[model samples]
Target: MTGTASARRSASPFSRAGVLGIVLVGFAAFIALLYFISAGDTGDRGNTGAAHASATGLNGYAGLVRLLENEQFDVTLSRTPSGLETTDLLILTPPLYSDPEDIAQILEARDYLGPTMVILPKWSASGPPNNLPAETADKFKDGWVALGSANTLQWTSELPAPFALTQKIETLEDDEVPQWSGLDQSGEVPTKTIAYAEQSALHDPLITDQSGHILALSVLGEEDSEYYNNAHWTVFVVEPDLVNNYGLSRQENAAAAIALVQQAGYEGDYSAVTFDLTLNGFGGAENLLTLAFRPPFLAATLCLILAMLSIAWRAFLRFGPAAIGGPEIAFGKKQLVSNGAGLIVRARRFGLLAAPYADLSARRLASRLGLIKHDAEAIDAALAVRLPEEEPYSLRADRLREARSSTEILRAAQALRELEGKLAK
Candidate 1:
């Protein structure tokens, strides 16, 4: 008996609390998995293009990223535009084929974002060919060219007019090295020349080449700028080659890049430097889920979550104990009759039961009238005498005995019921 009771208990479903706990655990596990998959650090901290900071290509800025990390600066590669909405220094290295209007939108949206540096694209490069041996392929050179011609400034023309490229590539003389403070010039500078441009009156010169064209310009913010105000500082670097992979190969160029980062006010702080990948053809795609959790639809997401929680709470509160059924063989005549009728109907034997039921009804009626020894015919004749002349009880009894289908049985049974009512009267 104890073993049977224990088995029944073990086979039962979980209680409300137990089910709730299981659901909560499953939800937590799902959230943890999502976080690990989406945001875990795999250490590729640069743009997605072939020659950006994350790439190992000759024109990439991976060396610059390493150099900054070596200097104890926290540098993160941001794959989404939301990562740009911070107080850190944001560096954007847009590709040559990128839309200028899109770049303009990103810049315009950075009203409250901290110091931003836009590095003008300088190299036209392609990836190495596929047919070479692994060692030779790994050492393949990226076919890069300096964008010094006027026609190559089409993309730059779409930028804010003050930061536009000027079709001039100024070559620095050996005696005309930059005099910027904090720049380490002990080692060789990779390229003596870089793309040059003129800045507006609002901009201040940070670095210049031999021909006096500005290579770097900065626009500082006001002293008491409000949050999200349009007064944040913006820096424009005319030549990216000065800090890219080939350039950073020279220790002097790497040092110069570090100095420029410090000049942008990220000298000592970790998590203060962020590189942008959205413009380099990475991660900016938005879907329904992403849109729902963003600004305009965030309230909708909250409402949906609340509705789900409310339903769950209601379900938990309304949960009741399991219901136990009665035995298959129930007591009482009404139940027995119902069960017998159900069995006859299920077996399609209603017509066969019609004659037997009529005889039993007649015998019961005769006994109720104190004529216990009378047979079915005598009971039917007595019923006919009591019933109306238009509907004879004997005729109903005969029809019930001769019924050959469920439909005929139903009609005869209904007539017999009417005859019984008349006989009772």
Candidate 2:
């Protein structure tokens, strides 16, 4: 049994199936750990509803995105606030329920970065209501409800200079469409009557209704206003309907929206156009791990990863072959006794074996003395008669039976061994 167990333990530790299973399990665990770490602290941002860049609903700007892409413009739907820090045109579409002060702060933060176009919210929309069945809701065509002036006014009143909208909605008459200020006329304009705005002193009205109320306005940067300064421009579109999905359904409306984007980029480059989604509550907050790998700490992160991989590689290459263990058990009865004693010592159970060993020693001493049918009391009497008077053998035998510790048991065992030697003589 000992030899077989030793051989099994000495066998190769590098079985192909075992190594493959360990590798697979380790890889799966690593992937799961990474996913758990990344998914831990993602903030509350739901990607749905109107004005969201990816939303395909009626009020979504997906149509505008497609149009820009078709025009060969590099359009990106920016989910994080950091994306606004670019030299491209940044378009912001805040929902009707959004706080105006928050919008103002975002604009102020991105003011000097590049040109921005703020599209005012016009519709309040949502998914089908809970009261409707899923099948019925899926077929529901009307999801957007137009917001009243009170709601629109509250949001507009919170914006900073050259960004507010008129409380009164100005409607364009049939056959009336706002034209780009410097661009020449081309085709029969779409008769889509939409809302327009009135501007402040800091704004230059670029597009106007027949009554001349500003439909679209341009706000130039302080440096851009001067002769040679190369600062980008900012634009404000009062009504979002003109460029949204419902508006862009007509070819003429699409043309007008494209012209607006071009106009915003007139000062510099129109190569890239980005729509902001941070304001709509998507990808607003970032985790600490993401920040660590971003800019200045990227080198440190790479070094850490490389160091870990190197350590793992070194450990893998360190194992050459299994070492041969010697014969399972040593020879001889003395060896067996030594092994038993060693086991008792390691187990710290000397006191437990003391009584049994003492009793067996007494029995053997009796048998050697030619005593027959000797009980423990008879053996004790015989030991008392034969042993020295000073150290009583019977008393020492009782002490061994009552021994409660390894030291006490060791002394009792030694006394028994001495008594046995005397009896053998």
Question: Quick one: best TM-score, which candidate?
Answer: 2
Per-residue lDDT over 209-303 for candidate 1, one digit per residue giving the tens place of the 0 to 100 score? 54456667675433334422454556777766667877677666677777677776634343468888766655543344556689889998899
* Prediction 1 TM-score vs. true: 0.55
> If candidate 2 were superposed on the true structure by all CA atoms, what would the RMSD be?
8.9
TM-scores, all candidates, are 0.55, 0.60
Clashing pairs in 2: none
Look at candidate 1 and tell me the lDDT of residue 425: 68
Stretches of model 1 off by over 4 angstroms after superposition: 1-49, 131-135, 138-151, 165-167, 170-193, 199-202, 211-213, 220-230, 266-271, 285-356, 360-375, 378-425
Cα lDDT of model 2 by residue, 124-208, tens digit: 5665566877787677554332233323446776676645556445444555654423233222223343456655666777766
Residue pairs with colliding backbones in model 1 are none
Residue 146 lDDT, candidate 2, scale 0-100: 27
Highest lDDT model number = 2
Q: Give all candidate RMSDs, comma-separated.
A: 10.3, 8.9
